[model samples]
Target: MWELRHRGAAARPGGEAASPPREGEAAGGDHETESTSDKETDIDDRYGDLDSRTDSDIPEIPPSLDRTPEILKKALSGLSSRWKNWWIRGILTLTMISLFFLIIYMGSFMLMLLVLSIQVKCFHEIITIGYRVYHSYDLPWFRTLSWYFLLCVNYFFYGETVADYFATFVQREEQLQFLIRYHRFISFALYLAGFCMFVLSLVKKHYRLQFYMFAWTHVTLLITVTQSHLVIQNLFEGMIWFLVPISSVICNDITAYIFGFFFGRTPLIKLSPKKTWEGFIGGFFSTVIFGFIAAYVLSKYQYFVCPVEYRSDVNSFVTECEPSELFQLQSYSLPPFLKAVLRRETVSMYPFQIHSIALSTFASLIGPFGGFFASGFKRAFKIKDFANTIPGHGGIMDRFDCQYLMATFVHVYITSFIRGPNPSKVLQQLLVLQPEQQLNIYKTLKTHLTEKGILQPTLKV
Candidate 1:
């Protein structure tokens, strides 16, 4: 039996320790298979079971994502109705219009203060835009220096100094007469500016280059500031020197913008895609016609009707100085040129009116360049606009870019063309004449005065 079992065991692949020399394990029997099953169960129990778990780290979104749209709708529904919007808009509009008049009422002083700020803003934007366009300046010093220089420009241009300088240099009449008499200080100021810039730019050896940018910055500043100077001077001089040019520029910008937005059909240039040919045509024509009307209305046909100082003070100085039938002439030494201007001022607190027509015409024809230049600059930098400070407009630069150049034009026009060589030039010319000839002219002038009996009898001498 033992021999037979050993033979059977040898025939099997595994021993008793491996599962089965039992019933059903050896052959195929029913209850014998139960024993084999029991053995397999016991063997399985000896080893520990593994707990099941998902290996995925990503979470699947449930239907909860659908809530987003509903949330947004509910939020929007919370806002005020259309009536409220209208009320808000109306209030804002009224506020804006009132502010505009207030600014105009402040007159030249307000305009000048705003101009100084605008210049600094303009220069800095150019520098910032330049960096993006060219990738040239990367150093901190360059930026700092530029800002510093801009501040200097703002200060210099804010006062009478700049206009005084413009009179001295750029607008210097062929006859050597300046609109304002003192210009030496203005010249000195310019030199100081140049030196300051030179020294400031010396940081990090970013020297000897980019004259185009350099010139552009200075010229823009100089031009804008000088315009302010002229306008302010003319304002104080009791003239509407500023009103004409400012109005013309604003009119051009506003008209073109409105027309272009509505009916623009053809692009004026690739750089300025929105400024249409139609807008240009409309703006130009409107500006020209307006110029003529403005000229007539403002100048009152170049005839200012106003009561004279003497008329107002009929009882004051005239009555007091009627003694002895021969006056001391008030010991006045006002140069003939000054006398002429004073005489004019003496008559009116306002200036000549002809500039309105002249300005309107000039602005309509040549002022488009201001818009074009700003457009080109914006395009060059791929910026949507210079800035968003103004509502419909972009920034200080956008509003005033053309004005800068226009101021130069007007200043030049008034100083060189409109006013003619200042009445002062006549005096300068008189002073330079040969002594004998000048003496004869003087004697003739005195003789005429005496003949008119305007001269006092001075001891019959």
Candidate 2:
């Protein structure tokens, strides 16, 4: 009977011999099996549970929708993968640039719409990545709450924009006036609702993963919506402020690619293996020169140099103002070495042209770090791109990673060195105040101006 029992135990699934216990010890076979199972479950939970698939399960080249033109496909049928990609990228770059010019011609409202669209697409791409990484698509209210938060954030930001730039228009509409008045509170309430929903949706074993995705949604919002908001703010400053910086970044990207494609030998960084020192240096010079010329051309145009403003009289936005000194050409004496090169002692250029140098320099040097950061993020997730939205460029987010960074820099630069207190914006704020408060401000300003002898002391009558 003992030999038969030993043979049956040895034939068990784990293939380990389960010998009968000796007299001094308790039979612990079942306990040992349970303990071993527990250890394996713990290991699985620690390392493999969060992701739905292991590394081997992920494909090396992410599937992308082929968007190549039919003609191009036939024309380049025999090209190698490398040269094929180069042509596709180059062609798409020019197409996007042409579309950009078309949008610029469409005016500021269209530009605002473009920014909003890009923001939504970028948010979607990032949130999609989060869902895939955590396998959280099954989580209740995940997509709903993510989109709800986006709506709330956009409401808050665009509300502030309306209150600032369209105060007159808002004041004319009773419903809008109320909404603008309670905008922040309403925004907070909307967000609080989403937060409560998220808390309610938490599952027993999914608490940690749910929190991870929750944080992921917020970070994605911060990157996409916030930076795009700044881009709009820069747009309102003037199209020149918007266009010059953006064009400089584009110019840098193109020049760098061309230089690198032809002459790249030494690698620039490991995060982006293809980036080259030759590209960096070549791009910097090209971008600076391009910015200078573009700024000069754009600064001369009132439509490009003037701040966008809502005109209640026309019930439309307008760009009409005396060009700021930054846009006006000023003469500067060249350095001794430059005098000989130019054959002139003095050169006249828009002050904004000088500022473009700083903008282009940042776009060339620091803006690329944004792309590198995106590259590292993709590597972490083992993703080749954020999405296959754009055939050759990866996605809208891929093209715009550096643009968002540039937008933030332009906003900061304008605030730090360019912008000052605006009388128009101040008046807009005052217009929304109560009559009594407006009267008080009027009296205070009158008294101050009278004391300064700027306003003829009105006769006591």
Quick one: best lDDT, which candidate?
Answer: 2
- Rate residue 378 of model 2 by lDDT: 88
> What tens digits encode model 2's per-residue C-alpha lDDT throughout 1-461?
44645554555446555555556654466456545645544543454444454556644544557777789888888999889999989888888989999999999999999999999999999998877655533666888899999999999999999888998789889999899989999999999999999999875445676787899899999999999999999999988889999999999999999999999998999999999999999999999999989998999899999999888989877999998888888999999999999899999999998899999999999999999999998887788788887667888999899999999999999999999988888888898889999999999999999999999998876
Q: Number of the top candidate by TM-score?
A: 2
Q: Candidate 1 residues 190-225, lDDT tens each?
A: 658766765664422233333434655566556555
Runs with alpha carbons beyond 4 Å of true place in candidate 2: 1-62
Q: Model 2: which residue pairs collide?
A: none
Report, for every candidate in turn, its global Cα lDDT versus the true structure. Answer: 0.53, 0.86
Residue 48's lDDT in candidate 1: 18
- When summed lDDT is taken over every stretch of 10 residues in candidate 2, the lowest stretch is 41-50
Which 10 successive residues of model 1 have the least lDDT summed? 317-326
